[model samples]
Target: MTQAPDKLVQSPVVPHIVTELPGPKARAHLEFDKLWTSPSVPRAYPVVPVRGEGCTIEDIDGNLFLDFNAGIAVTSTGHCNPKVVAAIQDQAGKLIHYSADFYIPLYAEMCAELSRIAPMKEKCRAFLGNSGTEAVEGAIKLARFATKRQNIVAFLGAFHGRTYGSVSLTASKAKYHAGFGPLLPGIYHAPFGHVADLKWFDEVLFKHLVPADEVAAIIVEPIQGEGGYLVPEDGFLQGLRKICDDNGILLISDEVQAGAGRTGKMWSIQNWDVEPDIIATAKGIASGMPLGAFIARESLMTKWGPGAHGTTYGGNPLACAAAIETIKQLEGGLMANATARGNQLMTGLREIQKKHPGLVKDVRGIGLMIGVEFDSHEHAAAVEWASFQRGVLALEAGMTVVRISPPLVITEAEAATGLRLFGEAVAEVAAKG
Candidate 1:
């Protein structure tokens, strides 16, 4: 019931193309980037962005695009949001960096904010970090430390992060582990999104591989990301909670992608009404700042002694300031906007799906975190490219799903326009197929 700020801007003319994609200037930048950047960087398309505002982006060329990707859902408030910018500017002038070893007022304030908003019933404490991977890694350490257990459980098709520990927990794709070998031991993968799968943890995993008593935690995405924007069937998350409770294991919700108002709630886990022992979040938490955190119950977090884990640049003041303002904006109705616009987009996509039943295999998700699945990866890639050509920026998730996650500030008109452009893209690709 929070009211949106009056400062929210009206929708602007978007998806405007003044030049070809990867135009002259963009091509130059791409060539320069290829020379200096690491080859591992995945460049989705050639739209070289220079700046962005609200739900719109402008490439190095004169072309404008309606950004449905939102920098992979990192920009929750919108690109260059004025309020967040003001907060960052103010904090930068006052203080920029302070190590975790010393007292940082902003860091304490940010943690307090996280505690207030955490989905857990008990009072919580937080450990801040620099990215989603770091958050997950911290959660892993906390789980193992608190439970005195070594084994961990994760889901197939879940992308936690790319760091050593987090990547070890990931099973979304094989290429992520192509060269990296001997991943962290005592980590097990379980089928995601079904009550029946929870039984496998007891019967198959515990009996055959690892014992339930040895498992430290079961880390899961409330709504799977990267693998696909897949929503679990009802009672699935509750089942996970029960399993954790019955086994004396901690329940860790990896909200790195689906948290921060993306799913019309403070955390995606809220949608399931299941309380997690720990929550790892990043991405949209700070409105594009390099900040992440793993929040746990007060009793559990207090058990860790000093110097057990720490970070230098994790709780930077600038990031904290931006995060405070971002949370305010979300509370001030960006979350509601996400719900409204998300419904509009989902409904429109389903209509488009009706036109090409064979091409679009499924349309599913909650709030603004949505996926349009195609019959094959090739068709999904084609539709994604076609959408890009039309100046609507979108990204692919899983092997054959196009993710639609735009800025929460996206207006109804903007979403409708995006849907129309997306529909055209799908039809174009469908005809070609």
Candidate 2:
């Protein structure tokens, strides 16, 4: 067992349940929510998470769930991390809001810190934004402006963001782009990893689809998060890097779900030696606060003038404070913890796969960013629902993949608990089949 740092704050006594989920109280709360909230974005889990600490979520109905989803991988430091909470509370008293034009100490420090710790630190400068979409938008703008080209290349099974500029670059599914019209022009799609033929990427994607002169940039995710935590082939990223370099196209890595110590490393690309020109990060940047950043070398970043881009609430003091402390905590041992925990999880899943071969086809991932691929979407949904019933909270990725990204601050014991519950759910579902 890996011992926790002495300074680490202890979690509260966990709650337990004696009744079914959504037991009366949660159902009533849902009724209230249905009246006030938009109908389009429906809630999945019946219980409303009221409070969270360490690796567990306590619901309004007093049911506790081992948090495997980690607020969709945003709260990597665990829920209400003490250092981050203290930073937020302290900053809230002094300053909460600031105009983008104003020179804020926290903002400057955050930018500096991100640049210092980023995988491509030697060639990075930070552009702070309010969300992942904003970071993607900034990357697109920078790529287009710097390269002086309009053609942008994205991979298949990619989910950049929901905004217009970012959405134009996303190629995962139709629904995300169905209703939207007149997306930014000259965007092209290429197959992700050349799964069928390894050489196809070099022969087709790089040489044919996106030719050198006309191409502006190639954007990719280190590990496809929303697209199913897909880890590309060994040399795929290095191949992309070479292609981008040969074509004078900038490579922008969308680490929105895989960065800020999610993949046991500060950045997922660290797993591969490939260095991208620009990197967009969010989700876990401020340990769940709305903070996004696009980083590039100072030379490439200088393409934008004063009025090139701006946002009303970008790099607010509260988020900056949270991010600063969050980064500080990640430096010591939390990142290594994620690596160790992830190995344990991957190994455990492999053992489960051997026991229930038909249910889980493949278990693949790095660090805590992992996915178990089921045979079909229906089976995946069944497993997810079963896990929910078993008091484990996990998320589905793509159509047939279950993502197991817990908070980095999760203990080895909590991981073992979640995995055991998940395995039980899988066994029950597989037996039915």
Using lDDT as the measure, the top candidate is: 1
Please, what is the whole-model Cα lDDT of each candidate in the order they appear? Answer: 0.92, 0.84
lDDT of 1 by residue, 138-249 (tens): 9999999999999999999999999889999999999988899888988989999988777898789989998899999999999999999989999999999999989899
lDDT of 2 by residue, 340-430 (tens): 9999999999988999888899999999999999989989999998998887889899989999999999887888878888999899889
Q: Which stretches of candidate 1 lie over 4 Å from their true place?
A: 1-12
The TM-score of predicted model 1 comes to 0.97
Q: How accurate is candidate 2 locally (lDDT)?
A: 0.84
What clash pairs does model 2 have? none
- Tell me how many residue pairs clash in candidate 1: 0
> What CA RMSD would you report for each candidate?
4.5, 4.6
**lDDT measured at residue 17 in model 1 versus the true structure, 0 to 100:** 82
